[model samples]
Target: MALLGYARVSTSHQKLTAQISELKSSGVREDRIFTDMMSGATDEREGLQRLLARAEQEDIILCTKMDRLGRNTSDMIKIVDTCYKKGIAIRFLENGLSTEGTMGKMVIQILAAVAEAERERILERTNEGRVVAMAAGVKFGRKPHQGSGMALELIHLDTPIKLVMEKTGISRATYFRLKNHQRRS
Candidate 1:
């Protein structure tokens, strides 16, 4: 039976160094570990899909935490139940939880519910804070691209699109969009 590992980060910019290191230190090889640079809430994770497909009877799936596998109870239970049915086991290193016995399965279900509640609370708090900030005149979305204006100015001077992109670091798509905006004005 293989000791496979799965690691995930909520966003692409977040590093998986710590998770990978922990998995390696737990005796899982680097090559045996699967990683996804996406949110735990998303089901479109290629790495997780591949890992789940590869796991077989008696194999063990290792993760740092339950939330790393999924954010909500339903999703977490689904994964655990899938492994359980396949005669596979899952060991979560964070709290020393494993799906090797009836007690372990019960604990996982309880913890899954708690973790899901915690995630909901976090989202609620974040949205409330954002609302307050917006009330105080703070912007919520990304600011306009910094180089967009300069690129547009150069383009207005009849500069080549490629030259403008090279000088201002703006993409061709953005140049066209901004150029179209300029024309409409």
Candidate 2:
């Protein structure tokens, strides 16, 4: 029955001090606090994964906010659901709620729903922006093949493929493709 603290900051510029202080003030042990200074969009965070895996039945998993748990609502719900199934409790200390009772349960559901809606809205807006950009003749991703001559020159330089890639920052596939395209033309 440990009171585990989970703290996160989305980027290097942000500080985890406030979150850590809050958790500590709530009686969370220093050793029990796990943190990740990475985007919540990724599940590959080592500290976060370890905290999730180490949490056990009747343990309290505390976070500064819902967003710290995940980038969106579905992911938050998935993490909460997993904890519930394990008899582990989730406490969003800032929100003053826990998955330990009815009101907390309701709040969790509402938050999750809102997060999911927000994710959908973001995707919709991004797609609309892309459409607008396309209609305006703006490019969205990598630039079109304008450096075929340079690619061919680099390929003929007697450099190893790895060396060429290191120098050009282009993958071997792209290098070969561009060289072939230039030869064909």
Which stretches in model 1 have alpha-carbon errors above 4 Å?
A: 139-185
> What TM-score would every model get versus the actual structure?
0.73, 0.63
Error of 2 at 83 (Å): 0.7
Each candidate's lDDT (Cα)? 0.89, 0.83
lDDT of 1 by residue, 1-185 (tens): 99999999999889999999999999998889999988888656899999999999999999998888988788888888888989889999998999988889889989999988988899999999999999999986767778988987997898998899998888888899889998998
Model 1 superposed RMSD (Cα): 4.7
Residue-level lDDT of model 2, residues 1-185, one tens digit each, is 99999999999999999999999999999999999999988667888889989999999999888888788666677787888888888888877878886667668978878876887899999999999999999987877555545556777775677766776677778887876776787
| Prediction 2 TM-score vs. true | 0.63
CA RMSD of all predictions: 4.7, 5.8
Look at candidate 2 and tell me the lDDT of residue 2: 96
Question: What lDDT does candidate 1 reach at residue 126?
Answer: 98
Error of model 1, residue 117, in angstroms: 1.2
Clash numbers, per candidate: 0, 0
